[model samples]
Target chain A: MQDLLYFVQQLINGLTIGSTYALIAIGYTMVYGIIGMINFAHGEIYMIGAYTALIAITGLTALGIVWLPLILVVALLCAMIVSSSMGWAVERVAYRPVRGKHRLIPLISAIGMSIFLQNYVHLAQGSRNIGFPALIEGGFRFGAEDSFQTSITYMQITIFATTLVCMTILSLFISRSRIGRACRAVSQDLGMANLLGIDTNRIISATFVIGAALAAVAGLLLGMYYGSIDPLFGFIAGLKAFTAAVLGGIGSIPGAMLGGLILGVAESMTSGYLSGEYKDVVSFGLLILILLFKPTGLLGKPEVEKI
Target chain B: MSTPVKKLVTAIATSIAVMGAGHATAEIKIGIAGPMTGPVAQYGDMQFSGARMAIERINADGGVMGEELVGVEYDDVCDPKQAVTIANTMVNDGVRFVVGHLCSSSTQPASDIYEDEGILMVTPASTSPEITERGYELVFRTIGLDSMQGPVAANYLISQDPESVAVIHDKQQYGEGIATAVRDTLEEGGVEVAMFEGITAGAKDFSSLVTKLRQADVDYVYYGGYHPELGLILRQARQAELDTIFMGPEGVGNKDINTIAGEAAEGLLVTLPPSFDEKEENQELVQAFEEKGEDPSGPFVLTSYTAVQLIADGIEAAESTDPFEVAEALREGTFQTPIGTVEYDSKGDMESFEFVVYEWHSDGSKTPVN
Candidate 1:
């Protein structure tokens, strides 16, 4: 019973973190889906999102707004706006100019942009890790008082709820909305869509904007959950989310979500049962195995060679 | 050229020559290097502020040996590579004395360069014993080693007579080294160490680690890392209802931990350098810091100030600006500073340094535990 409870606790822990990974992974997938290039600056966009949310929260609190829901809503909106604009600007300045060039060109440009944004934030906010106030606290505990107990905090619940709502809206947006249909057309074939009277550039920009907005949501959620923020926070997270995107199938939205959850669970389980030192090794090793065995991710479609 | 314009040029040339000669004799450049822009820059701020204050005060008191002390600052970002680069820059810039390179990893490598390049360095906060163990004649510190602090923490835990203790670290040089030291001492003291583990430094989630702690059923946990990770762990452990007592070294002693951990920060046991800022003798110095709106209570601040003071005193005692002679004088001479009486061994480590266990409160205040 104790072992089972412990396993359940690990699962809960994994799912909470995994869901956030999914949120960031969507950005990578959507960008790749439309443009066929990795937006390396996406992580910086997420970091900016976190910073914006933090600034909003701090400002609102200073203004004597003690209401939690209002604070979260405003912060989330502000983060989304800022991150979306950043994403749009990055695509315009870094990616669009070299759209038809060698893939490595945009990749290099993205790397440069990432460095620029990291330094920009570093200079603006002194390199100290500012502690984010733990606004939501307490949780439900399971099992007997003396035995091993499984615990879930209100913050974790908030993460799950927010991810679910975001995912639902994203799914609906992709499937039913007119702009969503236009996005699919552009992703299918940019030149063909352009010839068919769809505004390919606008669709591409919209994809970046939407992806960035979701990443912002993740940033705000993870920032609050972690209780701290720093300029370089996005680098490692970007790498992890990139891994998730590849593991899920680069251009598939559902694949990114699945890959993220699997990655998160793998990491937590490694930390729980084995050791935290081995968690990264295990997660990456899992990625290598998946790449070897499946080639395409679990939900990813095999690409057909162009004639 | 006209006769009057030629005379004007001659006058300007004479003043330039005079200024150049004055520069050679008027100041001794003390290189201040540390993480000016990185994650650990908070500690660097303390180091810079303290050293700068010492230089300002020393200059106001008619300068050192009738020559002004000029601090040439460099940023290492607390990275070993950056530290080495900064050390080389200091060498090329003709600096003979240095006051920093804060993290143990960065300090060790930078000190190696300083030792080889005939430069004297007194680190205010790097505590890894390996730093001084190299027997470098030029490398010194104003802080206690992890070897000293680990034993202090272990002895305290042993006194509490806990059933089991778990030791954890962030797997960096400083964190892992201190954790290993604590683990060794606890084992020697016949205490049961339920687990010794390492966590990724910047990773936010520690749920799995917290769950493992619960399963280990340890009554005490000693974390060897900076405040950010420990703060998160403290809050998570509290949320998980794990009521085990938590302890850490001075790295976890930052007041920002209060904001991160909130109420969970209360009751944290931290082994830190005795609060020199609170001492009655330091009241005036404390007032000086307050006037500038700077908090002098940070562990590194007074230690860094002492490092600068020792450098000045060493130069005076040796009666020479040569780094080698100053190094010799520092090893042999005893000087009074804000922290305490400073006397260095041949290895350039202080003969005696004190670490006190303090209980940290949620309001970002700490009271020494008797």
Candidate 2:
């Protein structure tokens, strides 16, 4: 019974972290869907978002905004603005210049941009982990007097709710809005969308913008949850998010979400029941296993073979 | 023009010969080796600052053994392979004494090369006992070893009388070595180690570990890692409301922990060597560092400072510039330094190194607990 409670508790912990991974993976999936190239610098954009929130929170606190909720909101807004600008700048500078080149060329440029951005942040911010002020603190505890107690913090709730609302709004916007339709059209048939008077360039930029905004949200939530961040944070996080995208089916939105949750739960359960040393092994192993059997992620549709 | 050029060349050659002769009799080079650049560079920088200050004072006071002491710096970058390359380069470059290779992993490997090549090494920060236990005569340290520190930390935790404890390490040499020591001592002291585990050093998410720690109902979390991981664990555990007293080794003794953990860093306990800044007699030294905008409170600054002091004192006592002779002087003699009277046993480990537990305050300063 104690072990069962621990497992259930780990499931919640997994879901919380998975939700953050899903948020970043969405950006990877969306950018990949439209451009057919991986935006490797997307993780750096998330890192920038974290720094943005850190600076904003620090500045706001100096301005006497001690209220936790207000500081969080302001920091979140600042991160979105800064991160969206970074996303737009990266696409315009790195991707747009290499559009007509080979597919691998743009991917290489993305990786270069990722490295450049990481060092840029490292120089601007000192190489120490900046402690973020805790926005959401205590949590609800569960279990009876005889059983072992488990907890889910309010910060975890905030992370889950924010990711859910953003994903929902984003899914709805993609399905119902004209811009979303144009984005879908470009993903499906770029030339057809262009012929239909859709500005493909603008739509592509919009995809990056939307993806970056969501990633900014993820960065802010992660900073608040972890209470510390570093510039080099992008590499490992980006790798994991990329794995989450691949596991959910590259370029699939719901698949990214499913993959992230599965990855998170696998890690939490492994650390909880087995040894914590195998957390990464468990998550990555699950990814390889899923790709082996499903070929497309759990929710990802099989790609149609071209003639 | 040819006749004048010949004269100029001859004059330059004459001065060079004179300077070479002066150099032969006037100076000795000690390499301050560590990661001068990389993620752990701040630690290297602290070591650099301490050693540099010691050299300035030593050189200012006429020379050690009547010859000026010169410090040559080498960047090992905390990689054992890089450390090996640096070690070989130092020996090749005529550096007979070294004061670094700060990380235990780097120190342990480089000690072998230093021993093989007959170069003397005195590490200021590396504390894994295995570095000395390897029984290299040329290798020595001014800081307390994990063997002493782990049991010191364990005794402190046992004094708290927690029902159970969780022992975690970052799986790195220094972290795990110290943590295992604590675990061994705790078990020997009749305390329960509810859980013992390892976590990846730089893993950003620790909610999973937090959950397990909570489920285990451990009242004390004794971690063996640096500030970054400890900071995250404190914040995450606080978020989970699984409030347990979090303690770590000297690696967690840094201002970084406060910044990384925010207000949750308050009251964090760590076992560290007695801070030099807290020494009443070292007030002037601490003030000198503060006046220069360098913090003197870092874990290794005093010890690193003391390493150079040991070198200078050894030269004076041995009355010889020979590396082997100076190493013998260090192992045999006691010398007064900033960290107090230092003496090394036959194994070149500190003879009676003392450690104390400190509590980190929210003001970003830590005070040794009474």
Candidate 3:
């Protein structure tokens, strides 16, 4: 019974964080799906989202706004809006100018842009970890009080439900929305989509905006969860999400989701049952194993390249 | 990599050297290097200010060796490679004394350059034993070594008589060193170390660790790392209702930790260089800068100030501005600084150092556990 509770609790813990990773991974996978290039700056957008919440909550509370719910709503919206705009600007400045260049050129540009945005935030907001109040607190306990307690917090529930809702809405929109079909067309063949009057520029810009918006939600959620953030949070989170994208087959939405959950569970299990020191080693090991065996990820479609 | 850019940097260096040479005869120059531009620049910024305050006070007291003390500053960004490059540049620019290169990674590498170049390096804040144990005659640290504090931490945990203790680290050099120190000491003391774990710094979640702690029913957790990771652990442990006692090294004692951990910050026991900031004798010096609208209550301020004081006093004791002479004086003499009378042994480590456990309170303050 004790072992079962521990297993269940760890499973809960994994899914809670996995949901946030999925939210961020979707941004990476969807962007890569439409554009053959990785949106390396996606992580910065997530970072900016957290910064937005930090600034918003602090500023609002200082202005005599006493209500927590109102403050949270305003902060969340501010993060989403600010991150989406920043994403749009990055695509316009970093990616658009070298759109038709060699694939490596744009990829290099993305890396550069990532560094620039990171330092820009570092310079602007100061490099020290900024800690904000948790959005919600406390948890519900499972199992007998005398036995080992398996706990789940309200914040965890909110995060899991929020990710589920976001994922559902996103999948429906992609399959049904007009802009979604255009995005699909552009991803299939950019030149052909442009010739068919699909406004490839608008579609790409929209992709960044959508991706950045989701990233903002993840960032805000993360900030609320950790109650601490620094400029470099995006660096690791971005790498992990990129790993998730690759493990999910790089450009597949469902693959990204599956990959995020698997990565999260693997990390949690490694740290829980095996060793915390080798958690990262195991995470990358999973990526390598997936790449070796499936090559296309759990839900990713195998790609064929022609010279 | 361009010729013009290279030329521009050379011109800048040459002009600064010429300017330095102009004032070289009248004033003694001390170069302070740290990460003034990186993520941990806050430490460097405080250390720089502390060094500045000490220099100002020394100059006001009619200078060391009858020569006005001068401070030269450099930014190494807390990176080891950059620190080496900066060390070389400082040597080339005629800097004979240094008070910085904040991070242990940066200091250990740069100490090589300082040693080889005959520059006396006094690190105010780097606590890794490698800084002192390297047997470099010129290398000295004002802060307590992990070797000293780690045993202190283990002894404190052993006294509590918990069911079992868990040892965790962030897997960095300092963290690993300190964790090993505590772990080894605990084992030596015949305490049950239920878990030996390492975590990645800057990771957002610690749920698995928390769950494991709960499952293990570990009564105490001795973490050897900075506050950020510990903050999350404390929070998640609270969320898991583990009620485990979270104790950490000095790296976990910070205002940011309280903010990060929220209410869970309370009851955290951390080992730190005894409460120097609260000492009545130090309050005047702390207040001197506080009056000037600068907060010098940071961990590195007094230590960095002591670094400057030691260098200045060494110059006075040696009766020369020579690096070798000053280093010899530092080894042989004890100087009274703001943190109290401090003396360096033959190895450039303090003859006796004290580490006290402090309990974190709800008001974002830490009081010594006593």
**Complex DockQ per candidate:** 0.72, 0.54, 0.54
DockQ of 3: 0.54
For model 2, how does the per-residue alpha-carbon lDDT over B229-274 read when each residue is reduced to its tens digit? Answer: 8888987777776668888998887777777777778888888888
Sort all candidates by DockQ, best to worst. Answer: 1, 3, 2
lDDT of 1 by residue, B39-156 (tens): 7777888999999999999999988999999999999988899999989999999999999979998998999899999999999999999998877889999999999999999999
1 or 2: which has the higher TM-score?
A: 1
lDDT of 3: 0.86
Q: Which candidate number would show the highest lDDT if scored against the true structure?
A: 1
TM-score of 3: 0.93
Off by over 4 Å in 3: A66-69, A305-307, B1-25, B37-42, B277-284, B295-297
Q: How accurate is chain B of model 1, given as a TM-score from 0 to 1?
A: 0.94
Candidate 2: residue pairs that collide: none
lDDT per residue for candidate 3 within B188-271, as digits (tens), equals 888999999888877878889888888887778999887778888888787667787888987777777877788889999988
- By summed lDDT, which 10 consecutive residues of candidate 2 chain A come out lowest? A144-153
Clashes of each: 0, 0, 0
Provide the TM-score of chain B versus the true chain B for each model in turn.
0.94, 0.92, 0.89
Model 2 CA lDDT for position A219: 93
lDDT agreement with native, every candidate: 0.92, 0.88, 0.86
List model 3 lDDT by residue over A1-307, tens digit each: 9999999888888888777888899888888888888888889889999999889999998899978789988998999999999999999999999988999998999999999999999889888777767768888988988878888898899899888888999888888999989988998778889999999899999989988998999998888887788898998998888888888888888888888888888888888889988889998998999889998788877676745
Instruction: Assess the local accuracy of residue A117 in candidate 2 as a C-alpha lDDT between 0 and 100.
Output: 97
